[model samples]
Target: MNIGFFNGEFIDINKAVIPIDERGHQFGDGVYEVVKTYHSVPLLLDEHLERFEKSATAIHIRLPYKKAELKSIIVEGIERAGLENAEVYFQVTRGIAPRNHLFPDVPPSFTLTVKPARKIAERNYESGVQTIIVEDDRWAKCHIKSLNLLPNILAKQNAVNSGNFEAIYEKDGFIAEGTSSNVFVVKNAVLYTTPLTSNILPGITREAILQIAKEEGIESKEERFTKDFLMNADEAFISSTSVEVLPIRTVDGQIIGSGNPGEMTKKLHQLFKGLC
Candidate 1:
């Protein structure tokens, strides 16, 4: 039976519940982290927890437990699930309260769920996937991994309707990021991606890939690029905790480079897997 952690207790998944007036449900007031596990151990767990704390602080939500306590809770949930590979999702909300926009006096609500990880299709990694450009409609504080994701949901659905794997968001003609990943472009054998700003989430996988690039002696830059640059680049890819290094062969029906996963992307993927 699946198990989850909620309200400081481990319980059967079906028995877990959050109050109706919980701020996360009523006002989307929460921050979350998704840690992918390998061999029953969470990969980059420390980095994920650090980012989670930063996200909560950005939204003024005080986490109920310390990082060490939260880590123990996650491990316990994973042990209960008994899965070798899984995705551990944990979140902290402003807490249960009367329906109001103001911050409540009660402690924050912490919840965690562990489930089997879904592997991306090998064909996608081999032949790459198509994506469409969508106008970014999220709020200014995109850096925070908040529960407010209406715009991202709409854009992701739009990508699905367009027969694409993901949506690359653009703000004022500048490529920002993907609906759930970070965008990177290869131009003249150099890598370029958006810098850490309010326009995009500072993805943990994105940072890992950059570190790999540096270690592998691959040239990289964290500067923003225009739509034309993205469309005309030699190659492109998106990265996330789940997706890892997903190559983008086409964008809005325009072929990228040779319309295949680039050499640099394949190398980075192998290096990333080594780290995992």
Candidate 2:
């Protein structure tokens, strides 16, 4: 049976339980990181852990273990769960305590789960995906990957109800990013993405793509882009741990790049797969 790690101990998911007084349960005071693995090898693990540490530190949530020890735990969890080409989820919560809006007094709780890899829909990968635009109503500290994601959840739900795969968040008519991924626009063979700011999550896959583009001699820039720019771009895509490199075929019912995957998108997808 697959194993899960809860508070530094391995247990079956069904048997793993937490107190109702857990601070994460009452206040959603937690942070998380998702790392992708290919062929039993974790990709950009150090970076993920770094972000994890930063997120924890941002909220004053202390990580129970050091980064190196946590990495070993994640690797062990992956192996124990028999995961190869999969996703590993790590989260830390403020732990159980009396109900309060403030930080908890108890130690933090850590959990890790590994699941079998699941690729995006075949059609999405083969042709492209569609995204709907929604206002960015999330908290201002979007740079920290926190677990309090009701806004993102609602936006994603709205997109799903509209038969779309993702939500591209708009702030003041500008495209911030997909609810849970980084947004990219390609025009005239140049890649444009939002700068790492307080408005969006700094994605690990996004960083890898930038490096890949550099090595492949592709021009890239970090600048603010409006929704109009996204609607008019020759190509667009999103990157995340769950969805590696996904082409955005449509934005708000308007066609993007012939309403199909663009040449640049295909090249990037191919290059991304080559890393595996």
| lDDT digits (tens) for residues 124-201 of candidate 1 | 999999999989889999999999999999999999898999999999889999999999999999999999999999
**What does candidate 2's lDDT look like per residue over 178-231, in tens digits?**
988999999999999999999999999999899999999999999999988899
Regions of candidate 2 where Cα sits further than 4 Å from its true position: none
Compute each candidate's TM-score over C-alphas. 0.98, 0.97
Q: Give the runs in model 1 whose Cα sits over 4 Å from its true position.
A: none
lDDT of each: 0.92, 0.89
Clashing pairs in 1: none
> Residue 33 of model 2: what lDDT?
93
